[model samples]
Target: MVKLLAILIALCLGQAIVAERIVNCYWGTWANYRSGNGKFDVSNIDPWLCTHLSYSFFGIKDNGEIQSLDTWLDYDLGFINQAVGLKQQNSNLKVLAVVGGWNEGSTKYSSMAGDWNKRQNFINSALNLLRNNGFDGLDLDWEYPNQRGGNWDDRANFVTLLREIKEAFAPYGYELGIAVGAGQALASTSYEISNIAQHVSFINVMTYDFAMASDGKTGFNAPQWAVEDAINYWLSQGAPANKLVLGVGMYGRSFQLTDASQNWPGAPCRGVGAAGAYSGDGGYLGYNEICLNNWYTVFDNDNAAPYAYSGDQWVSFDNVLSVQWKMDFALNKNLAGAMVWSLETDDYRGHCGEAYPLLKAINMKLRWT
Candidate 1:
């Protein structure tokens, strides 16, 4: 019905852009486990920063019931209540719970979506979970419906699940969205774009995590035109312009340069770069960690993104300038809005002088004076 409403709004307004553009933000609950500046609680979030806040990675049981991944911290410790309570501060905020992330895998989702009786049970459980917990709705994050250890029938059944979920959500005025894969080949196999887009309130196209080749070379995690290309592909496949939201990653993929002299795209890498202090994960660095570095940064004019290199370490990530380019592309395409993968990674500590710098860049570009 959200799409229908958008169509009505566009028709009445006599313009291409419909309703309000949303900044859908995802919050990883595990960030609370990180020590020092890495520790991010639900309360640390500025409620007004995002139009929609998704509490990510609530698990699913064999019985199709939604389970908090961290029962102790998320539910018993009141993290769920704390996240929902943000709505009290900003009445316009819509807090959603995400089920079936990359870690959850496709087995549970495929099993639940394939069976008729199970889908209804899942819907009932999801609704009860949301209404009882004071959440605005659900954002299904099944990584890939048909692939990743799932059955062949999943491609069609996933649509049925979404359709039923959207129908069930309509009476309660709950929003239903999905995090879709951005790769061309993966997207074709995983989703029936037009069919699924019909049932969703919005589609958060995950336009990052790009790896160029298997040649042990380095590449930008998300290039500006690559994001635009994903948007265009989805649109061409019949997804609605207003229901599509472009995704931006708040982290960078780092690689250790094999020879310090060759420090550009396709340059050979020894392996993952040294771990960031906060993230403590090799091959990855948050914007908070990346921006604080004194590395020599170079911009890729063709891609409209930046990668920094110092010594044998190199990382490709979107800074404010590249983020602006992405948002501009979204605007030009008449897409709904922008989505940041997770709020925790994007310079949230103010060590870079301002907090949520990349997110603010998205908001600044998407919002007009």
Candidate 2:
């Protein structure tokens, strides 16, 4: 019993240090992690990676199975509430539920906008979920707010949603956050970022997927230059530096070239993804898949980006070194924090593996300077 008590005390102290460290939870749900154990094993997983376990809550279908965002809320409340209880019993792990995503789009948000009653219902539902489920906060991954299929009417409505959510969550002491795209086009089309900045705790910029063309000749998906530009634009547009959390990709993009004659400069191959296959959807492949297929080799410099090439296939993806560069950028600029995509894809065991090491380095650095 004495030994057990000592171990518990050590764990409590560790958790306190972890909670104050940087926040790095993956979207925690997608094609890869839609429905699984709902609990990630943080034992081998880096505490930095699993420090904040964010489960996605997006299922917008009809036919009334309590799906969509509504049912997703119940799902998180049920599983995560229990998880939080476990967190208290065992200690460590501050979990959150993310709403909406890139594929599901932001239609529900559009529908809930303008109407005060419906808006209240949405906000109340979110707060209730956090209260019942044991979530530390809420992340609004609305995919997009303006642009393309997004309704212009929902522009101001998006702000309203943030305002309502902030107000509702404030009383209950829940954190409010949003995932934004990382392009000027997004800034132009999405909700009023400047207006919404001060309200939410911080903004997670989706700073990857630059152009998504699978052809190996394309530029970096989330180039450091591009990311810096996006952040500069946001801050120039009035986003508080300390309230911005840069987003990094734990994946890579691959492309194949047609032939020597057709190969574009820096694009090593004829096409990308599935080996010479064309994807109208997007040409990029993730880092996990890249390693799994053994299609591309990673190369990194001090610039905070990695590049790889295989045969006619050539691609550039970000790695921990590049990520550390960005972290330094965040620190120098006094930004809030940084976050990665889904945690499942990180290179867990390899000479090139860096997700955990880099995260630990960041936590260590934050502790000092």
Candidate 3:
């Protein structure tokens, strides 16, 4: 057991960096419903794998109040209770409840933020959710402010919503954070970065999904250069390097090649690839499924990212090395830390060999300085 003890010591030493950095890991509760080994819940999570655990995603009501999207999974099954209870095991763990997600849409968020009484209603409900659920804070994930069929005033109103939330959260020592669109095209239209950054503790920039299945072309889901560029753009827009948390997608974007031999990036795609046995979802593959396969993998020279293909199926994702590279990039730039799109998507099962390999890789990169 001496060998194992020594190995554990080495791993523990690397985790020292997270104390000053933010390794925010989102736990999408939907994973509990995934089939077979695909299922992941509070019991399966390693508390030590993250500095901050965001329980996604609480929904927004039409009247601008906080709502639980899955009442049974959150309340009836005790996921929220069990999630916050983890702080008992890890004193440093900060569990934040995220409100709003891509599926929640911008219509209600726009209506809420754009109205005065609704903003207060939202704030009061947010406080109630935190205090009632024992969540340390709230993560407002409005998706986008002015886009997605939202109002024109949403750009400024989003900041107003954050300003109020920040004020309300202060007296109670509750932290406020946001997950924003990262690309220039999206961020420019979606946020007032400088102002929004002033109110929240951490700016979780959603850097992944730069290329999706709908693009109709093969591309990296979250390329290293793309991530770097997003970081640079946020910095240029006055987002503090120390408060920025790089968002990493723990899954890959996949597509079916229009032509068998045309498998390079930008290759025409006929449609999304077949669903994975474990992921049970089309157009995306969890690292657990991808790492175990022997698909031919290629590294993009310009972006320094990797992609794998089997016949007509093509996917772009990060391996351990690519993840570490981003971590190194984050540290080198003095970023607060990196946040994964989810904890469930990582190879948490050790189906290949090591459990939570992506999480471990990111854990190694969690340095504040």
Can you give the TM-score per candidate against the true fold?
0.93, 0.78, 0.94
Ranking by TM-score: 3, 1, 2
User: Could you tell me the TM-score of candidate 3?
Assistant: 0.94
Query: Cα lDDT of model 1 overall?
Result: 0.88
Per-residue lDDT of candidate 2, residues 192-271 (tens digit) = 87888968988888888874554335567777778898989898889998788877777766566555343333544545
The reply for model 2, stretches above 4 Å from the true place, is 1-21, 30-45, 48-51, 60-86, 89-93, 214-217, 260-271, 275-284, 291-304, 349-358, 361-369
Global Cα lDDT for candidate 2: 0.63
lDDT score at residue 161, model 3, on the 0-100 scale: 89
Q: What's the number of clashes in each of the models?
A: 0, 21, 0
Candidate 3 Cα outliers beyond 4 Å, as residue runs = 1-18, 367-369
Clashing pairs in 3: none
Which tens-of-lDDT digit does each residue in 1-369 have in candidate 1? Answer: 999999988786653232368899999889898888889998679877798999998888888777878889987889989999998899989999899889999998999898888788899999999989999989999889889988778888988999999889998999998999997888988988999999999999999988633449999899877777788899999999999999999999999999999999889998898999888989989988899897999999998999999999999999999998998888888888988988989888789878888988887777532
Ranking by lDDT: 3, 1, 2
